[model samples]
Target: MRPLNKGAKRQRVRRDPAPSRLFYRWQRIWLTPLYRRLISLGLPMAALVAGGHVLWSDPDVQAQVTASLVRARESVERRPEFQVQLIRLQDVPDDLATQIRQAANINLPISSFHLDLDEVKARIEEIDAVREVSLFLRAGGVLEVVIDQRIPVVIWRGAKQLEMLDAEGIRVGYLDHRTDRPDLPLLAGQGVGPHIGQALEILDAAHPVADRIRGLVRVGERRWDIVLDRGQRVMLPEDDAVRSVEHAMAMQMTQDVLSRDISVMDMRDARRSILRLSEAALEERRVQQAIAKDVDNNL
Candidate 1:
């Protein structure tokens, strides 16, 4: 080899110390606060959720979990504190209490959780005699049922049967005979249920003839006909019906008009009172008229 010049030196290759582009980008994202937190917390949660889903997907596991939960619930519900030993009725007669038990149809020694109080209450209130009802569990494992019985205010004689009704015209119970409730005023004829208030007012005004009055008959569902014991009736108009009754009572008080031999006192016309005489009275009037006519002709 030829001798090299001292001024010409050999050159060496140099390498970069920084990381690659992909590794640099990944490192930057990993250093971020949100990404670091997510990486730390999310991975365990995701793994846990996936494991749970896999385990629950097995039918055997699902059955075991369901059975465990049911057993737990039963244990809690079957405790003495949740047990209903018996049902007690408050403000209910013995007969009605029996009826209530029949209506409730609940077996004894049931869990209070299993006893649907609302459904029991609804069944109890279905009775015609029950105005309202309340149900609750007493401290001594007794299911208490409180009842408000419908009080009968009047006796209604329907076309085919007789029934007792409350003040609101709701049927309370059926009657075997009119003598069953002699205290309540008797109401008859169609559409009388809705007009019970008006009928009651008329009855109140007829207190003077209460003993002689039999019942009130609704005429054509528009007016009232007060029937008396001795085949007598006071026909009242639709408007001012109570006032018409008052007028009849007034006449009875002053003139003893109800005691006369009149079949019907027609107060339908407000201006005048027309009296339909009895058959006997009509015959007597005809005979008298004939005698008077004969005497006048002879004169």
Candidate 2:
């Protein structure tokens, strides 16, 4: 083993010290521009080849692309904001869900791209009590739908089948409200629109007014008539029916007219009123009074 003596090493280096920087020894480095360019380009070229090998050589590229596409589709479909919700005047019944789904035509191709609001609204209105529809597109691709329902105010008890009509005389077709509606007045014959509408209006104006209306029947275009709930008929003269109805109402209140078992309240004469009771009804009333008298005499 040789001992390292600072003195010996200093004597060897004292004459001239080696260059402090390694590159300082290469005096001609800047002179070779071609070499510099090649050296600089070498690293990027290797990286480019390596990247190309990774991109093209792998058999899983197609699978990865397909997987990405599937994920994108699933992500869109599963998003909470994209879920569709619907409501009706009544919540849609599960039993009718199939019918509603069919009516919506969701799977139809062109339905997605094109919209016909007027047509859709018109179709929806065709339903028995549907009054309004609201539709909106959700952010994640879902659609929200809502419906408003109409209330029936009159009964169109025609010869064939009974239908529910609104104040405007619009038919609402067979419905579940028949039990409740039966308590309402029944329009026996055809051409009972404005009459029924007028009756409902008057009835709505004040409580018990509607209950007194009984029913309105259309006799030819020449005349109109109203039937009281008490099984009496009131003939209204042709023309100014509104005034006639109002007059009849006032006369009824003044006379306590409806309070009696009056047969009819004829407003046709314009100057006078007529009353007619059915023979059977009069007989029944007479019998009821006789029974009351007999009971009073015994007491």
Candidate 3:
């Protein structure tokens, strides 16, 4: 091979560097391997979310989506697996259960998905007797309704009719006559329903005089008057009237105070006790006093 001269100009095989494939020049410096993976996943997801938001904003698209969902729901409801063949009720009287069933207004073999359980429960609970109600679909495709009936504690005599109330003072039912539930205690007067708690407490404290109790009479929407079987009444104080009743009961047990010919025993003043003598008793006392005076004068 012939040697080339040292002074000769050498032809350089210059190749062009490949152009950067990255869209943003900064990405080449800032984007790490993990960042590249995140970008690959997040960009498509963000695009899908943005597109969905835009589609949802359109009224026509919204209507179409709603219609599609409704159609899907209807199709699912038509299947036998979703159908309710029967309804069962627990903890309800026969008449009330029948009423609840009627109130449900549901057709047989109805789809559970189509039934609004909440509306059914609300409707059933609207009955004054139903204290609480729960509805659910059983495994056997029966719509089960469980009712908690309010237990009547006392019969309240209103202006027009008598009402049965629970211990919590919730009116549960109506009574044609107060004698229907003679076993239950009777309460009368305005605004007496809500104060059943205090009334019950007072009655309990007056248990010593239960046989003599006619009924409790609410006075001025506050305080109480324990009416005895005879024409006698024990007036109680406004505050802590239960204490007053208990005190009266204790006095009656020891002193037979209620057995005396007293028309009224006013214990309204906690500091002192007062009793009003009956007309007969007052006349007898006056006659005795007059006889004693005559004897002293003669002596």
Best by TM-score: 1
Q: Would you estimate the TM-scores of all the predictions?
A: 0.80, 0.51, 0.69
Pairs with steric clashes in candidate 1: none
By the lDDT metric, which is better: model 1 or model 2? 1
lDDT of 3 by residue, 1-299 (tens): 77668678878888876657774564763477776766787778999999999999999999999999999989988888989999998767888878888888898989887789889888888888888888889987888888889899988888899899998888988999877998888888888877898898988999988988878888999889889976899999999898999889889999999999999999999888899999999999999999999999999
Off by over 4 Å in 2: 1-102, 105-122, 131-134, 176-178, 182-185, 194-196, 202-213, 221-223, 280-299
lDDT of each: 0.90, 0.63, 0.87
Best of the two (1, 3) by lDDT:
1
Task: Compose the digit string of candidate 1's lDDT tens values, residues 33-120.
Answer: 8987787788788999999999999999999999999999999999999999989887678878898899999998999989988898
Tens-place lDDT digits, model 2, residues 115-202: 4645655666566656666766645444555666556677876776778877777775554544666666666566776566665553
Which prediction has the highest lDDT against the true structure? Answer: 1
